[model samples]
Target: MREVAFIKQNKEKWLNFEKAIFNQRFKNPDELATLYIHIVNDLSYAQTYYPKSKVIAYLNQLAARAFQKIYKTRRQETNRFLYFFRTEIPMVVYQYRRYFAYAFILFFAFVAIGAVSAAYDDTFVRLILGDHYVNMTLENIENGDPVAVYKSGSNWGSFVGITINNIYVGIRAFVYGIFGGLGTGWILLHNGIMLGAFQYMFQAEGVLWESVRGIWIHGAMEIFAIVVTGAAGLILGAGILFPATYSRSVSFKMAFKDGVKILISTFPFFVCAGFLEGFVTRYSGAMPNSLSVAIILVTLGIITFYYIFYPYIVNKKMTLHTYDSTL
Candidate 1:
């Protein structure tokens, strides 16, 4: 958007924020923090698009003061770890919600591309998944155990190995964002396409149900965490690409901090998914259909709520709680 039009759009909001800062109208530290968030966003825009405008200086000074007030008036929050997970991450995620949309939309589109390409060409799946893996899976399908590969390794060995691998994948996805988010998109594309082709291969073998019962036992949270990590990478890239009112270095530092926090939040989910994959997925064929389905639903629900819905809930409570203090 053009600088003048952008300023015209956020001008009134900035004025109100200025008034709030000067008059001490914001009742709580959270409110000041919230206002600081707004100022920083505007400051980022002005820096990126209106670097030469006087408004960049104006927004920067206001943002700096608001930021100081947030730290100065803040009560030391008890349960720092709990607060980090319960309050901080959710607020950050809410602030960058649009990136989630981008990651999901792009990943799913890539998945569809893989599925379409595989459907038309028998060799596409073998090319993506490797000939040996495809042949093993096909042999397993014929043997009536299409997911036998997951059953290989001792449970503890599998758990530790898989957890580390999943964490590595998440970190790779986040770290790759340093290259302007294209690297992160590539990560998503690689995985999403593989997933699409993998599933389609099972369906073609007439054993999708058998594969899903085992795969989705862990895939739900595992896949969702990857998507969230991809969003964090995009957030990092945005810092480099946008740089609002800050210098490139400063913007990159701020973005890295926020992106790391987001990436760290998914570590627990990765461990959980790893546990399920190592212990439960291998036994999915033996499990009652309802049990397998329940595990998949519960895992999916937990990650979906935490990363997606929970952010809105936390933001709402913060807004209402702080707004009520003024009365």
Candidate 2:
């Protein structure tokens, strides 16, 4: 690109940096720091292509000033942990909202395939859910309790074990994204198939409502966290597959960090899911229909709002704060 065109292309960005950085007057220092990174990159570009031009000198000066603000801000930062959960993760989630959409769409598609295949093939459920599980569930059904497996373990024991297992599954789903997202998709595929087949088994047994009321007390958040983790994995995959304007390494680093943030946000949800699974799901079969349904809806609503709706709300608030800060 010509120096004139390059300058024209980035003129607004440079102006915005000046406006954002000059006074060190922003509510979100993290965003300001991100802007500084861009400025430094622009400085590098100018130094390479416009070494003799005033743009290099200008950008260098902006970067130097911004560096001081970022440095001082970091040393003084007190609410970093709270800010991470409150502002950082939500911003990251909003920035990568489409990946969540893509992940969920792919998950639902895989689930449909699982369900349709099970419907058409008698042994498909056994193939996916394993013989031992099918036999155990069948026995539970014969005894008038379809999900009694959850009742076996002691409450605290169940909670600890289930929490650990859920975290493991979530981590596996996220780390697999290092393979460029296919790994994450495979995890989704594996889990989606199991879920579909599991549900179809209940439906075929003529106790669909019985199973739902029994399972969804905890399944709501458990499954939702799995899909959210899948989205985190896709973010990793996107980092590797599409670096966009960044070098591959830089893109991967950014994606990995964002993915980790996303993964971190899910830990509480997993814990909550595990708690319900251990303490509540075992009783779901005997609970009142109204109570079971309310639990299901509430659990689903909490996770749905956090991962689906809350990101937009948080992002808008941050944008407004940024705009107001500029004024």
Per-residue lDDT of model 1, residues 67-137, tens digit only: 44453365335777887788778877877788999999999999999999999999999999999999999
What is the alpha-carbon lDDT of model 2 when measured against the actual structure?
Answer: 0.84
Q: Model 1, which residues run further than 4 Å from truth?
A: 1-77
Best by TM-score: 1
Estimate TM-scores for all models: 0.83, 0.80
Predicted candidate 2 versus true structure: per-residue lDDT over 35-120, tens digit per residue: 87678778888888888998886776566446545544654336777766666676677768888999899888888888888999
lDDT of each: 0.86, 0.84
- In terms of lDDT, the poorest run of 10 residues in model 1 is 67-76
Q: Model 1: which residue pairs collide?
A: 44-244, 47-244
